[model samples]
Target: MSGTTRSGIPLADVYTAADVTAEPAPPGTAPYTRGISPGGYNDRMWVMGQYGGFGSAAETNARFKRLLDQGQTGFSVALDLPTQLGLDSDDPRALGEVGRVGVPIDSLADFETLFDGIPLSQVKQIRTTANSIGPLWVALVTAFAEKRGTDPNDIAIFIQNDVLKEYVARGTQIFPPEAGLRMAADVVEHTAAHLPNWTPMALSSYHIRESGADAAQEVSMTLSNTVAYLDEVVRRGVDIDQFADKLFMFLSAGMDLLEEVAKFRAARTAWSRLLESRYHAGADARALQIFSYTAGSSLTAQSPHTNIVRVTIEALAAVLGGVQTLNTSSYDEALGTPTLESVTLALRTQQVLAEETSLAKVADPLGGSYVVESLTGQILARVEADMDVIAEHGGALRCIESGWFAERLSQQAYEDQQNVESGARRVLGVNCFIDDSTIEVPAFSVDPSAEEQQRKRIAQTRADRDQSEVDVALDEVRRAARHGENCIGSITAAVRVYATVGEIYGVLREVHGPYTAHTGLG
Candidate 1:
């Protein structure tokens, strides 16, 4: 209470109504500060989506079934590094990382195995982190649906396809910035023409926050990046109204209770104003839908049980902030994959908040609070100021391509760590509460044999398919990429022929070339 917010917004003691800049408008109105939905959870509860996936296809399939049985309403796939990078299980580079942190998926055959018994129509949403290979990921899902005699339009899907964020905050980028933007737009264009229920983009601020962005900076970068995508998509002659309303955002729910809540409120305020004023967006597009995963960066390995308390606070802020979908991080995730027990505990946390607290009865539980309102206004102002700086530096894409965004994020990260080391910031088990005590926390481990099984599966897929059909499909994909045609159609064709993810990406690599590191543009 004595210090400023993580983003340097000043904190005051005993806020009064005098501190609030504007009086309240009703929820679901213009400049939507109170909440997006008029009735909020009183009408429909937010979807509880706990993120989990690990090891081989069959192993992860069992985990998905278990999660669905435990009352999870959606899917949040965490792809392994190799899969995230578009590498196959048999690739030499994928040897050590085949199935370490998340699920390994090489082709449609793997998806067939991964969702063997799960019904696609029954799931509310299926979201994954597929930035660089977003177009491929969407095609694979559509192909899998066709294989099972399900219409792709009936199954709601979401892909985290913010490729610009990959260049700055995450390291899985496989294309140049300009080329990546084009690929992301290709998904939007193809989705608009084909799968109407699918959301091809989930603009991400979660990674930016984890990479050391504060609340205000997180809001600024996210909106700035949104502009880049909107410009590209609309440039393709696609009407903004048709697909803009379906766009999703992924943000962080941090540990700071009041500021985190204020951040979400501010994000909603800024986004609504931008869409209405800039793009002439309608009511549906202005009501922003947010998906938050509790700050994974906040979890401490020292006293891992303390993470339960951390996630609870973060998830509470997300609910108060009025998210459409939410996932709570498991306590043991920092140490290893979460055990089933830990995952259930995480899900039950949301159940208690939704069912027992009676917090869902009101639209905006903290709507008119003097402190919340004041903090929300202040955070929005800071976000706008930061956006001005981003514009002055030639916008988000320029900042990322020139390494300006990376430089700023690294600077903030360095300062934050310095504060913790110097005791300016006190973390519960990390800096304070010093003891010689050791904590034992249970975790889930990957089986060593999973890698070999994955390799054999990939080999069998290759041996079983017609090489001539795959060759023709790959050639068509290269043609689409070269001729500036939307590549989703051809990519889906390739996946149907059992062309591996790496093979599809390999074709693009030849056409677009690999990415080279950027030095700051001075």
Candidate 2:
């Protein structure tokens, strides 16, 4: 009997060498189907990263220190919606939202408080999930480093500067599509020349998957978005090799165990081929690095404890698929912001998977399995076809601007919701296994006074800073944005002079204009 994968690819019951038409490469070879590193985890284990940020900067700093002390190798930041939208905590547009979902960072002072006693130089990687305001985060980090007498070049920063994905999936976009692309590419060009150790752009399929794209759509759309970014940067006079190696991709580990693994393996293979054949990227550039977070959408509010098991399984899939970095969603994430106990449990999940399991000893442990290999090949082919469709629509940027991509994802999201409602897709606690148990998961809540405190701080900062110098710096940034010049340096200068995130973004907002999603397409 034949079956179908979650991505709607046909699957065979059994397979032989006949199923594998292409030459099988080793773990470290180009078009890395097996794995990227020759030694794999034997040389170094994947970074155990935890995604966190909430309330005030001091509170988030304490959480970061606790996670680091508990053996988290890397840390990821989640900025509040107000910060992500380039509004100050005190802005009328930001009422009731400051420090609610994530940390509220209004100025360099907030960044300082966020990092506090943590030595950023020792952190393996600092991943910030900021899209439209990504350059501001970069500037804050650079200024913070300089204040502490640390060279920004020594820090390994990964910014989710994939603004195109923001337009299609996440709705935190600020500027219009064309201008957003320019800002995203500007970060790549600036970081290539300045921060040598930083990975400027993390092409995120995670949010796309969470927004309801299937495995195939997630991988294909991400790669197509990467193509848009690569073209933009190359047009700015940067070599393919210069910035390609610094690029990274983020995928989502969902409930389909084998299919999730296959999706990742196929992504590595597809990325390698695309870079080599199209961009002429060298070996280092072709060896794509992936970071994955277990799917937040997969967690169920009903029987929230079951989410722990779901996260473990997804994290295992990421490890088996050879992810370079992994973050497991907390069990209580479906309820609200993760409580301290829940986040600790999430970190322990990674620790146990890395320390107690023998799965990491070998690279691509399931590389030769009949089912896995067959699925991998099928996903690669399907993703390529999806890419062709995207190209036919005049590429990723055009599709995004015209709302084609948004319409497709919205339809898929509607269908998935319908499936769950009709009992076509079985979610254990949500749809199938009815339970009378009370929901007892402890969820984190932000202090109501956090907004007031942030407002007072920003007001004090404005009173203390040299108003003349701040005006000059803001003007330089405005000039750079208006004149089509690289704005990273000017933005950094503004950040150093105590300019607020809202101030810098306000300048750009004036230049590029705001973006509102077109609702007519859906």
Candidate 3:
């Protein structure tokens, strides 16, 4: 039967070698079309990086330890809205939101509490998604490292510090586009010089996809943002090879199984060629390493129990797509923050896929299929065309500032909703199958006292710290910001003195001024 992929690429019924023109490179070779590693999971299985964090520091710490005990190799942190917005939990704007969506962190003390007894050396990696206040998070992490007597260069820390995507899709942005780009570039430069094991920026397409871009638009927009970041950092005088290998990419594994797999393969080859042609990057610098999160938008609230099956299929697609790390969403994601029971099921989903299915035994298992190969070629071509449109608008930043990117994504999202409502697209439990049975899954709730407790702690922390030293360090931060120097060193110094996130951000806001956009960009 003939059909079309989710990105609207037509699929043929059958296939043969005659349909394939250019042969794929062997696994572990340059361009990395077949796969990044020759043995794939046979050499080493992908990291089971589960994204989690909520409530108070102690509660989040307990959750982290539980996941580690359950064979989770890496941990991904989700900071609350206040922390991501560079506000203290006690701020008037942060009152109701503190610890509501994720963990509330106001200073280095909270970072220590969040990590508590977990040895940084043993944890494979700690991935955090913090855009506007990423530098603050990095400083807090560095301070935590110093206190633990661990070398900062020895730990694997990955920060999603891409502010450009914030403008296009997500909305946690603090500074204007230019100032935000400067902040991102400063972190990149600082990490390249000091932290050899840290990936300073994870160019993320996950948020874009969650924002409702189709697969082709997702890849194109992400690559365009990458180009913008590279151009900014290159102008800052850093060599391409020095920080290129340290950069990682994050994408979403949606429910369209074959389309998601093909998108990943196409992304690898396209990124390799872009690096070589545009930046003259070498072999090692051209490798496209990816960490994927299962699409949160695909979950259905109609029958929350069925989300377990959805997560399983999405996780399988990520594995087949050759993702370096995978995160599966909990079954109760559409209902609320995942309960411990749901989180356990999500982690078990990965284990079942890795150990029971035997899918990881070979690299690029579907490499020779005519349908897969054709889909990969089609995705690449469409992505290139969309990228060309971005170039016409003066690149990703320009498209964002002009509202073109946001407008396009909104249009696509509207179209998708209309498709489901009109029965043009079938969303199993949501639109297609009518279910009258009421199956109730337990909902996860944050502590009602969490906000009050967090506020008291912040107040006590401020009263206990040396106020004069905080003033001195904050002055240095303002000086660095005013003088166009890399602010990371100064921020790290301020964090060591126990400067709160809001305090440091206050100085930056005074110096850089708050970003004002008229285009509804964020």
Candidate 4:
């Protein structure tokens, strides 16, 4: 019944050994066309993470505990928009937004409050959804260790420390690209030197897809950005093997069923080749690709209840695609942040697949399928072609600097919006099956006064802390930035002295200036 993508490439009806351009290697081998790790689910189940953040630190902590109690295997913390943009909670530009989208974190106190009773030592993994607040992560971990009476190096943290993408695409950037990248390098160097096992970078393809790139484009752009980071670190005279092993991948699985599955397979193949051929990385680093949560952008506002079915399909795709970690978006994501009920349902979605579905019993069940193998081959070719185009233009960062990549993405976004508006693309409940009287799903609501309370917290933190210590810390941060020393160490110490996020980022801006993305289409 199925044909091909809208681009009119023929869909291979079935796949065989002859159909795949390269013969499928055994799982855990070079290329990883089958899978990356051996004894896939038997050795480890995909990290099942739940994304939620809202209200006060105490309130969000309660929510975090509740999810963990509900069978969530790991935690993925979400920060408010102000936090994401590196602004203090009380900044005027942050008006009407505190805790509206995610949790409010203004100071180290807030971090402690949010993690009050959570056992950092015993938790499987904790992903801090961060970009601009890379320094905050270091401070938070240090504080957590001091409180637990353990070495901070024992903790695991995967920060979304991909700042260049934030500058060009997400608009969550606070410092200039050069400076922001320097801060990221600090995190990479610090984590590699200290934390050792913790992953410092999760080169995010989630935002790329959210911004309107297709699945193949998403994989290509992410790898291109991965190359950009490797270039930055190699120029710093660090060994790629040491740092690249700690770099992981973050991708999105939307509603495109087969395409999404093939995307993951293609990503594994491309990442291995990129690491081995381009970076001269060995098997240890080439075999490691830490995959994480799929974003909620694919959810539809109309007939929102149908999103459950959609999420289930995406979860299955991620698993069959051989992801090491996976997060299923809440069904009611479009209207608001997930309610506790919605979050539990999302976690249960993964639990059910693990316990009930036969999918977990076998590794790469689709590995030998004629159609799946053929699709994976084509996707790998397309990704390579796209990477070639990026290289011709001088890599991903250069493309972002020249505004070529963003312009292509912007055009794709424009076309997608038009497609939905004109019915050329059908979003199940949104554009295709509409009914005026269809039942409305209840949307999650946040307290309107939450922003005011968050501001009060920010003010209290500043007043209660030693002002001179903050000044000294902030000065040191700027000095580190100027000297090309590891800025994360300085920023980390500064935050412990109650330096507001804005204050630390302001120091970076002072030294390195702010990045201004090219607003005009080229």
Model 4 is weakest, by summed lDDT over 10 consecutive residues, at 1-10
Candidate models: Cα lDDT each: 0.89, 0.90, 0.89, 0.80
C-alpha lDDT of residue 132 in model 4: 69
lDDT (Cα) of model 1: 0.89
lDDT of 2 by residue, 146-221 (tens): 9999999888788988999999898999999989999999899998887868999999999999887999889999
Off by over 4 Å in 1: 520-522
What tens digits encode model 3's per-residue C-alpha lDDT throughout 415-507?
989999998888888887868899988889999999999999999889989999999999999999999999899999999989999999999
Task: State each candidate's clash count.
Answer: 0, 0, 0, 4
Model 4 segments more than 4 A misplaced = 6-9, 12-18
User: Tens digit of lDDT per residue, candidate 4, span 107-165?
Assistant: 78898899889876667778877886776677777765776688877766777788877
How well does each candidate superpose onto the true structure, as a TM-score? Answer: 0.98, 0.98, 0.98, 0.96
Compared with the true structure, what per-residue lDDT tens digits does model 1 show for residues 231-304? 88888888888898788888899988888888888998889988988898888888888899999999988889
lDDT of 2 at 25: 91
> What RMSD, rounded to one decimal, does every model reach?
1.2, 1.2, 1.4, 1.8
Report how far residue 249 has shifted in candidate 2, in Å. 0.6
Locate the minimum summed-lDDT window of 10 residues in model 2: 1-10
Q: Which candidate, 2 or 4, has the higher TM-score?
A: 2
